[model samples]
Target: MPLRSTRVAIGALAAAAMLATAVPASADDGGRQRHVNHVLLLSVDGLHQQDLAWWISHHPGSALARLADNGIDYSNAKTTFPSDSFPGMVAQVTGGSPKTTGIYYDDSYNRALLPAGTTNCATAKPGTEVTYFEQLDKNLNSIDAGQGLTGLPGSILSMTGSPEQVIDSAQLPVDPKTCQPLYPHQYLKVNTVFEVARAHNLVTAWSDKHPAYDLLQGPSGNGIQDLFTPEINSRADAAGDDWTQANSLTQQYDGYKAQAVLNQIDGYDHSRSVKLGTPAIFGMNFQSVSTGQKLPTSDGQPGGYLADGVTPGPVLADALSFVDQQIGRFIAELKKHGLWDDTDIIVSAKHGQSPTVPAQLTRIPDGPIIDALNKAWNNAGHSGTLVSFSIDDDGMLMWLSDRSPTATGFAKSFLAGYSGNGNDINGKPKPFISAGLATIRAGAQAAAMIGVPVTDSRVPDLIGIAQKGVVYTAGTSKIAEHGGDADTDRDVPILISGTGFNRSRTVDQPVATTQIAPTILHLLGLDPNELQAVRTEHTLVLPTVG
Candidate 1:
């Protein structure tokens, strides 16, 4: 079923109708507005807060600047640790973090069923758990078999390898003949803002550059419309095509996504009397900039190098500008359709890129660390010791056997040795490694190191933390990357604007991406605490409605 066609279905039609009528009016008794009927959530991949602030303040002609001037901007919005696209987006929409959602990185270690003291951590696998959308689908399944969804079709076409093979050979899951959705509703374990809005009979639409929509695979129980890029299907198809047409592949795809948003608007406008009354929510993501294999220029040009002559060039900047233009167009269209007043526009990013500098590379001898750690475990007869160590973009995560009680001690000793041997950049002593064991006992320490955080559950024995600006190098590429403790990767911009929102207000308090979902619910006058994964600490009570 194509994602565009799927409509929200309700089991109790009469109850749904009553709820729709009961949708809190935007007006208070004093004729003051109290609700935000529409929300436009936009995600710009690889955007940094500093970059956004710089462009907005310096380049008044820039679309972002215009938006910030007209809306509320959260200057200190930050993403969760182990920042990456998958986890970042998940946190943005789920109101949960890696610790709660169990989505730490793009690829994480999973050892749920493994035995303790097993040094074979190499056998651990990646996670494939339920996500936010899945929970909604199950809850709404009684409504109907919501097929012909708008976004699913495009996603399927794109996944069939129409343009290029997206997943590496090792990353491809087992073939499941049916069109696999990149935004598999099943993987999401919590209720999203979309679900909450739909419960009130509000229409919702999303456009994103990330694969969340394309990767959706499952019965969409909530019946929300999902319009996304198409995916390539078969191995033969994956091997037989050039998915790289500048105009047709990239530009056309972006245009189509934009059209999806417009179409939803049109549908709602035609069906409802008011322009803003049609779709209760609309969202779109622009990703042309991050596609550049290289960086953008520093002089605001398309392909120039950084001041240090190391980071990505102007190609990134040019791409971002292009996306900015598209955003301007989108806003213009909204105004054209007279939906500007009621619609709330939210702009943010998944993560930021690190400058790929020569001095960033740091290599610590893996042999000594791994050998000593393993020997210690083996000598203790922790036969179940499964140890898997890999170099991350900025640090190393070692999965020890589920029995290594001394995992934290060993990890500290290893870092000490690495620093003592001058393996660290700038020869600075490495101290204070972040470990999960601080909250657990000896047995729990072993479990945490293996990628299991929950007690009586499997987790990593020891997780390492690297200093900022440090990149762990294992092979050819000297590229600067994320998945570290750097503020650059972890910090992101969070902007919210719309009806009932505080106009031109800037919040200086620190906010995490995980709080977005619950905050959205709060803004809509819904119970955010109802979601099991919601973090009370992170949830911010906006001045809007509730």
Candidate 2:
């Protein structure tokens, strides 16, 4: 669909909703009065809390430090489960967990949706119903018609890359019958925050690394398929330049997205001031260090570049510096446009990455575990590996088929015999399964044997911990990976700043990525209790509104 017509239609729909209710604002309404006029949501992928602290303490005058000094810092922010891009991003936006949002990982198991006997990552889809920003738009529209005020903008801009790439990778081989993308946005069962914003006649914009902008263009019958505005921008492509240098590439992409946002803020019709609002919300996803997979850099490796064994190479350090500069520029532009004082800026990350582990270090052999398990299951007349297996950060989760009664039991028994025990890598005492079990009690015992923390809902049903220098692989170049039961994969930084925020206050309370959406909503004077995505008990205290 043409991007122009898409925007026009969205604008017209919002205008019509506004005109339909030419009523005066009321004070006694159940909905809280909108206190926040502008919100800027920024997501920096692969950012750890230590990285933030290091930037603040070591790199004075850095953009991050400025924000930290002026904002409230939540030191214990974390991603809920399978700490990968898709799940982490969904958790951040939806304010929900995998169990509720249904976005468990970059690729998740969906047996009923796909053909039987599928085990590959390329064949997965949303196993349950989910919802995203599109739904949020619809709700916002409902609010506009019901209330006198203009609704919020439900637009989303992301640089995380294409949802299509993620969906395609999750599925097995494409089914010859359907001949369509296996995992589409239609699979999401709930509404996203952006959807709510747009329904209220607010302008939304996004800039990111992926084609996410294009995928989520408009509401139903509006424009883009994903219910986002404009769909996407082509600025992420670097002409004749490799994206491996973290500093160089991050600076370029961040500057590009930041400029796009500034453009909208500049063009906004602020003359009407209180009459017609400008772009209400803007978000950007900066992806550069992730490209480090193709670059020759290490987290703590020596011999490249270092001071006192801390190898802060040009690749890593430069990228950090570049992103910091872009952030400073973004803030400057906001101030130039006279929106800095009123706008609330949030800086956070989707997830953090651990250093790469070379394949030669461990020398583990390629095993026939999948084939053996499949053959064993078929021979047992149990419909062939009913539980699809995939390796996650720290362990392997076996997604069982709803139809298979003994699938869980079969998985428990099959995983019991693996040689690598959980505690071997970390010196922490953890159980190692030597063979499979026949009962649920035995399954529990098996899990305990492997040192897998049972309370973390995000942990895979079956767990495996790689030795310190060892990383499991499908023989690909993605040497550095996450999704493990390790500290490096779980820790992320959350920085909240701007407009009624208490500056320089550090809170050490444990907060997960899932808490962010609700926090933002609450800060904006929206009742987060209305959204099913928010946990009932998780509430963020914001600066009081008059």
Candidate 3:
């Protein structure tokens, strides 16, 4: 079955062209000619380089195959460590790792901030978990995030606002210095490609699963002029299925965002009601692929592979096909609107799912690990629990109640000796943690790995990288997860198609997704140094791109 079409009626091409904003020449352009007037950046979250190669080879003449045929495919591209959606996406726009971005994960700890709803930031207890996910939504269960005039999901297609307008301030982390809610943008320590585009008088736009993606607006908080976010976590229908629950439902949810991109291509706002013209930089992320890699179908067909783990299974194959069809639609629309020649399509993933090989899989609950750590702390005569917060998947990241060397060392020692007593995905007696505890990095070492200092408030006190195939999940819903340094989580696909790309070329050199930010600026005739993170990290543009 094909994805449900949510095409929005757009105005005439001539009218949209008239409304199109011109990209002004920047002094920082340095006489570099712009090869593409518009750049469409799409993150097909959970797409691995291996998966891209397999898809193109198996499905010749498909959208992905055609893109690769005309673009430079970076076969060895990797995302950042602690490879969660937030940090991985941020790395693409900021050209920096968690160190410079100060973003470890969506739900991370900030020692300098107060808990949400703390009115008196100056007097409230410091150190709180900063959650930038659907929890911050006015109503996560509603498709419009409960911010639209009407309750129906369709009403948001013409809505003119963003999550920033509906986010409850009381739910955001309070900055002690400002005594105000620290929005996602404010939490970012550096500028983004969108900010650079905005500074150059170029219009920018984007769409994602949740409003918290407003972080893409960069530090200025207004980099994206046409930000459209319909919550993916919102209930899909009367059946109560959500985007994450089933692959089919995820495709339906992704269709809404894909239609918005089509509207942008037709020179209209995401709403398709306003003729704002095609943005200089615009695109939306696709959740279907990610969902397929993680969740089973409604029919109980599991996600991932069939033993080998390289070849996609039935549920995943359908997801790959759905995304390909969407991309085909995007290309057709761009040509219809005469924007193909002036446009470039950049496709990559924020992060990839783990334990592709079924034999390597082990599903262990995290409750035991937390309980063990806390118990160890108490046994050592600690007055309070040593663990302040933790987010575990294929790996574990923990914030400590006390970050002192002694406290950090004690916790690390305890975890190093701790053994997994959980079962595998099939309920077999397998170590949940396996031998992964040996790779734990504590305190200063953990921060140093990401190029941050020990004093960095957002740095986790301990990072435990799981052994291959060890997923810290007890539920049967998902076979895999991200947010780890495993190859399946960090190794992702990256390809740039359209004008000026080396046709049918492949680059196998090890490269990081952080390079995508500088490349975006470079492609648009803007200095890469314009992005603060690019300059700070000395990030370079991708190879073989002129």
Candidate 4:
């Protein structure tokens, strides 16, 4: 079935054009004359580069296939480690790793955070660190907090989402005991592409799953000119419901946000706040692909699962087809609005799901891991001090509450040679925190397994990486998942195409999502160095220009 479409009744093109805000140009920086005026970055969450390749090949001559014909495909591109959505998106905009960005997952232990508002961390004690990214706002009903469908966008095609709406209900980690709620815009430690564009007077806009993604605003002053988020995580009670189911609502909401970008191309935001005239950088993330990749259909259908060497099932095919159709619609709209020639449409994923092979999927409950952790603490002689921790991405992004060096030292020593006492659900007895002395940082042992230095407070201490394909999942429904050290978990397809992107043909050199921000800046004739994180970390940009 095709994705349902509901186009907003936009005012005449003339009115939109009248609202067009000119993108002020910087004096020619004496480099290649850049003509790329707009960027449409579509992140099809949970899409693997291989999956995209499969879909395009199957459809033969589809919109995505055409995009590949004219673009450079980074076959070896990888998402930053801790491949959770939080770090994944941050890497794209910040040009930095968790080491610098300080985000590990949607919910991770943070030594710096404190509770905000009435949402208390029941697990957090007076002297302990903070837990961040708890979506505490989901506890409300439509009428509970004056939030109801009445306030939702009348139509996705008509208005850009307010970044505020997305974060209003999220229970964010705050300063310890300060009750200062952590706002998305204020959480970023690095400047984002949106911020840099705003600094350069280039109108910018974006569409994401939730407002908390406003964290993309980074340190820039209201960097995003038009921010629209559908709050995919929200659910309203029956009294608050307008007949739309939450899942279907999220898909529809995603479409509307994507349409917001289409509206920008038409020279205005949905609300006609002003003539946006196509921001230099704008794009939307499609959750349908991600949702379909992992979930069963409402009527219970075989969803998109890639069994070793097998393509997505019928249900998944629909999702991919919908995504392709949306891209086609976007491209058509861009052409209709005369924005195609100078635009670049880049497609990538926030993270790839796991069990690329169906049989490799496992359902080892988190109990074994948690039990083993406490056991390790007991063995370390800290039996009385039960420290808090979070399984930030299946051990790949583990975080402990105790930020002290003593805790760090204990974690390293314990996990360096941890051997679970038949507690693993694998029945045959799975090992704990695998590490090899031959690996780098032999001094830190288990700490070196994750490659983060012990002094990095924002990172996890005790590393718990399961063997490739052995997922430690607490849920029974999700068989294939990501967020680990598995090779398939980290690798994602990255295709770069645009009038301004002066590169063609694939490059095998190892590259990461971190290069995206600086590359976007360079494409716009802006100084890539303006992204401080990239400069400080000596990150490399993809070879894009002449």
Candidate 5:
């Protein structure tokens, strides 16, 4: 592994303002060091090392092949623990862990949140979880308000789905016990690289699945210059584009947003008229791979049967091809614009999907577990806050009712007795949770298995990892899931290419995505330590660069 001598060219936030006056590309220390001014960060929701291998073994002439040949490849790159999308993405940008970012998953129970939004909290629906996948604010406020580039190449149109979860710290119904504001972003204890870049007046732009991703904005303002997202949950189609085509609607959504990156590369944004020129940092996440992970063969060629030893079916192949083609286009556009040399492109994924082997699919329903917990909470006669549940692929996140210790104890006991089978010790297989009560434990033991801290605020009071070869689902979604410590869930493809480095190199040393934030800053000749989270975490920048 090689190390680059990194220094903070901008001493302080104030220095950032002073230097902000310069154009997109600037020199470091009176031109003593060459700098890569532009950085395009692209994330595939569920890209895995295996997927890349499949592409190489299948499509020999893929853009992926070109990238691997041109830049440094981290053959062993892992995402943050829990491996959920929210935490995975944050790991790259915040250079921190779930504990540092306080983002465990997109869907996790936060009793700290105002139990309910504008709606009421009821037993049937535990309102404790602050779903980061929000499309609209609790007030139904549109997410399009000034979220995109002010001036546009085209108007940043209003998006469908929920809007940015508008937060007026003053308005949130504070938790009576904690009396703490329940805003999601507020929970992110540390800042992201996005904010650090902005501190020096660097322009950054990003497009994700939803406005709720405003979390990337970090606590401090100045994260993105232009942020564009179409409500991911919406079924609406872009004009003249039929989502019903071979392209999965989800793939279509991802492709649509990827086009935004194309526009940004071309010196503008979805705000067609606003001349963004080229942002210092910009990129978008692609969901095509994720969509392919779950697409069943019944769905057709675009539908894939991707599992261990399984060459991608037609659908999976199509998905990979689509992504490869897009990457080629991105590279070509950068070259055409002549910004290719000044820009560094990092193609990676937030996390990997699980159970690549179809035989490993184990669908364990949550009905029994939920029923037992609810009943126990009722028996405890405590605050009676119903426990909230989040099933992350194979891992389970259970936020026990915010009641007395009695309620939690009872819930735990019931879980302990559960066996997905009838009895814990040796009972008959439970009906719904056939593998239920498989392994019920918490604290460090549970966290150790999944690689998350039991003490993490975002961690659930009770985490359930189904029995080996078991998953928590009823065969509705994809075959393999993520969010657990499964190798299939953690190993992701990491490629650092484009203008800065020469000749491709492969580093087998394991690197965490946490290093990417600092790596970006380091490439641009900024002090990697300026990113407090990475600095505080003692994260190192990636090895070898321009």
Candidate 6:
């Protein structure tokens, strides 16, 4: 395929340089010769810098420790706030926050979009909830995503990177302007590092929890040539196993994706059945750690940290060990293929689990909050539901049916005085505070924080910030949640290891994961400015590494 016109001249130059050079290396700090032919970007979801430091300190001989021994570990790396997985992952690849990405969470509201099945865009009122998570799957219940093939996991493994096959377009929100369903990639407002790599003709691949991760494909919709997404929310067994319900089950689920990375390292596709060559840019996200940090065992063993809130409990420790072992496998396979010297490994997290301290956890049902708003709006003679769409985890984001300032102010005022008794995940009664309205953002305040204009339809009219230890789910399935402004939700680990890094070094300088996008392109001998988000946000490469 030909390169995009904007990069055609640079692509030709790069092509000619590759023909003339014999495995040349890019020079970094202290005259380090970095022969980075491949970049392995791994997101160990829910991994915090503290967790990584504790694990490495406890296990000096571990693979992660070994990588850190030769890596530059950024001691303070923050992810995007309202830190849901979608926005967090998009921030890393696009070098932009929710402001520029036009994505807040997997489930958000888009005022410019029509209903999923709305056939007539011209006449219908434009506004609908955007659900890009597992709902888009062909079969949310099947691990294979119900591709309708003979084999079980193998069928999902052999997918030809066609997201359309796994995703049901009819379920997606329709673009009123085009009267067509908008895929995850089309929902994105900026280009990604994967798109930049493809512009340079480099092969790319990524494995994650859901097919909805096709959002990483960027606006071009073909950034990743080999995208393997096995649904993590699908049943783990025919007996109806939920992967996220248990730490052990989550580990078992993550193994499939770990094996896919190994297959890619072995010069085959995700299935290990076809020789597609190792991707220049490839990686996967592990969900075990995230699961362990939030869920307890089926037998009632607790998850999260020990009493100190810093040490990983038995469940979390096991989860961390599983991921470390998988990392060891990746390093081993890379070495076995004689590609270790040419590969750079960047490890980070999409988002971190909040309220590491189990004792601080307080569960509250989000239903009452929405119910109060809806009732008040109806009582005031407003038509339809007051809150059009809302997705609450540790935080509450509400898109109103009537987005007027009067409606927003009325909702905010109600929440400011809202108080009730709720039950914990264990069904123990607890008192609920007024949704922490002191820190909450509404109207223009909410828009400013999101980096969007107040009139932008995508911006939430009111963002209710839950208390530090408050979780919105009343279910006993999880003790903690993400998508909040807590330090535990946004503070994550960022490790740039492999060939070029000279020695073990921990820098205390604060950085954001968005810098990873530009840094990856810079390390791979591609122009960082080629990424639209990087240019729009003026994102710089990671300090020291770049």
lDDT of 3: 0.77
The window of 10 residues in a row where model 4 has the poorest summed lDDT is 12-21
Candidate 6 lDDT, 1-546, residue by residue in tens:
110000101011100000000011122333233548799999999899999999999999999999999888988888887688888888888888777788788777788889898898889998887878788998887776767656765456765466667898889999988999999999999999888888888888899888888899988899998888887887766667667766777888889889889999988878788787888889999998898887745336678888788999888998999999999999999999899988899999988887788777777767666777677778988777777767677777777777778888988888888888765645688787785333667788788877778899788887777677777764455677788877888789999997667688887777888888878877787777998887877777777783
> Which residue window of length 10 is worst by lDDT in model 5?
13-22
Off by over 4 Å in 6: 1-35, 298-300, 424-426, 436-438
Better of 4 and 5 by TM-score: 4
Worst 10 residues of 1 by lDDT: 13-22
**C-alpha RMSD of each candidate structure in angstroms:** 12.2, 13.3, 8.8, 10.1, 10.9, 9.5
Residue-level lDDT tens digits of model 5 in 1-546: 000001111110000000000001111222225578898898987788777877876777788887777788878888876777778888888888765566777655554455444343322232354545542333322223324433221333433212233433343434544555445455577887778778888777888866667778777644776777655543233343222223466565666677778888888754445776787878988877776765444244634453443567677677788888888888899999998889888989987775566555555545545665566566767444356544435665565545345444566577666654331111224343423434555545444544455554455665555454444553344355666666767789778886445577877777788888878888777888887776667777776654
- Estimate TM-scores for all models: 0.65, 0.64, 0.92, 0.80, 0.79, 0.92
Regions of model 5 farther than 4 Å from truth: 1-34, 117-127, 135-183, 237-247, 297-299, 376-392, 402-413, 420-440, 444-457
Provide the clash count, candidate 1.
Answer: 86
> How does residue 185 of candidate 2 score in lDDT?
48
Candidate 1: Cα lDDT at 496: 74
How do these models rank on lDDT, best leading? 6, 3, 5, 4, 1, 2
Q: What is the lDDT of residue 42 in candidate 3?
A: 91
TM-score winner between 3 and 5, please give it: 3
Per-residue lDDT tens digits of candidate 1, residues 1-546?
111001111110000000000001121112233555566677776576766776566568877776776667877777765565556666666666555555544333344422212334455442222222212121122111122234432433222211112322122221122223233344344556666667777765565542334222212335244434332111111233212112123444555566556655565322122243446655665544333322222224433224553343556555556667777876777778887776667788766544333344343333334455556656767553335433244544444444344555654554444432323333444332231111222345434433344453223344455554444432222234455546666667887765454456676666667666666665555666755566423454432322
Model 3 stretches astray by more than 4 angstroms: 1-34, 149-151, 433-438
Model 2: per-residue Cα lDDT over 1-546, one tens digit each: 100000001001100000000001111122334457677777777667776787789877777887877777878777654555556666666566555555544434343354323455354652421112222221222212112223211212221222332222322323324534333344443445555556666665555443322322322211211221211222213342223333344455455455555555664321112222345666777665444422344333321123321334455566666677778877887788788777777888766654433221221221334455556777887663443434333334443432222654665566565544222122333333332111222234333432333332222344344334333332223334454334455577888777455457787766677666665666565655544555432434322221
